[model samples]
Target: MSLTKEAIQLITDTALVATAKALDTDMPTVVIPEGAKVVNLEAYGAFRSRFRGTFSTNSLLDFGKYVTDRAVGDARGFINQDEMTCSVLFNLGTEEAPGHADDRAVLKLKATAGYQAVQAISGRAMSQKDMSDWIEDWNSTLSAVGEDNQNISLVKAIAAVRTITVKASSESDHTVSETRASRSAMDAIEATSKETLPTSLIFSVVPFEGLQLREIILRISVITSGAQPALKLRWVGEEVQREEIAQEFKSVLQDQIGDAAALSLGAFDPK
Candidate 1:
């Protein structure tokens, strides 16, 4: 979010050139006295030099940085604004004992959600501490809901039903977690089984902390798979909850922008 001395100088030079060009076109009747070095837009260079020296000094460093960032964005392009999207990663495992790679889930803002975030961030006037606290609240308040559990922390929610137990007619119950294990377990049970097992899984999701916890129930498809067993997880009926999270996230992003709009999250490169 900072510009180097060399970059500042280059941007200043470019601005000076554009201003000189505009002045030349607008004030063609103005006369440059003979023997004056101000002929050919030299005056603009002098003015730009003095302005750059005054603003780029240590006392006005912040102002200079702001001006430079604005100029760069207007003349070139924004780093994060164009994408209009923000991505969040939810960690399902504890800090010390992290879960598998698949345990992590990513949530990204849709186009409309991103628009709301942009509006919220740009419309707010906040201080640095306020922004920090807002972010903390956003992270800590997120929780998930299940059929049996309500308002459980997102980190503790089960991403998938890792294990299930099924009983055959004459054999003891078999428990399986992986796809291969489920396939093998089903093969042995189907030989004597008359009907497929009726089972459903509960999933909890909190799109944002402090927002509503959503419940998703995915039914196991044992009859459809025949000898093989698969758990396909998908759900509906949480559109309102998702929208509420998006709105709450907008407020958080507003705090993230704080007093300086240039300091917005989109100002940085994802890389």
Candidate 2:
């Protein structure tokens, strides 16, 4: 996060104010003759101005940013993950495709698993990349935090997700990639037949190569009655700006190329 010039000034000013308090408490009282100019609390504007100028020019930009972020983080408070409890499940599976003549298209169904573990950490240390990754799986993680209803904080929500084998029916049954999302996440997707709850606030960005992903929260409810789970494309956005994101997802899903992948999209209901 970029710190504004005003925020930097406030930081310097606050520090200067604290310094003045410490000095007044520890230093001996000074009596200056009339017209004498000794810097004191009365000259706070000047003192703060000079301090801010020096701080702004110094190469402590990183330090300044860290301090500013710390201030903001403290204001946001911390999340106690241990007191929090949640249900968890996530998985990935695939099937074969026989229609395509291309050898690379021999497989019809494919799913790649993500292996990134979720855990709460210092939000002050969170960067843009961190936000992107967290929001990508926010709903699944939230499902893990389901029904806790105890005013979940951002950092806690970010870190609350952990895959539990306790509820997964297909744990380790499908490990297409070296990395895969926790079983809890997969269970979340299957249990609700939706990517996330409607109330979930997800954050995502657009890709230059394809459609802009406006719905930070995405969904792929499946037609559960089928022998194999097929995605419900129309419900991807669940009616939020579906006109834009729905078309974009459909176009991209069609243009995508890979192994053991199915590009099936149609009207289907959950069994």
lDDT values, one for every candidate: 0.35, 0.30
lDDT of 2 by residue, 177-262 (tens): 56664333233224341122222333333422234433233221223444433222122343454345445544443343211132
What lDDT score is found at residue 89 in candidate 2?
Answer: 8
**Which candidate ranks first by TM-score, i.e. highest?**
1
- If candidate 1 were superposed on the true structure by all CA atoms, what would the RMSD be? 21.5
Error of 1 at 65 (Å): 14
TM for every model, in the order presented, reads 0.26, 0.18
Clashing pairs for predicted structure model 1, backbone only: 141-209, 141-210, 142-209, 142-210
lDDT (Cα) of model 1: 0.35
Worst 10 residues of 1 by lDDT: 50-59
Scored by lDDT, the top model is: 1
Residues 45-135 of candidate 1: C-alpha lDDT, one tens digit per residue = 5343212111221112233234334342211111232333332212223458542222111123343332233234332443323432432
What range of 10 consecutive residues in model 2 has the weakest lDDT sum? 84-93
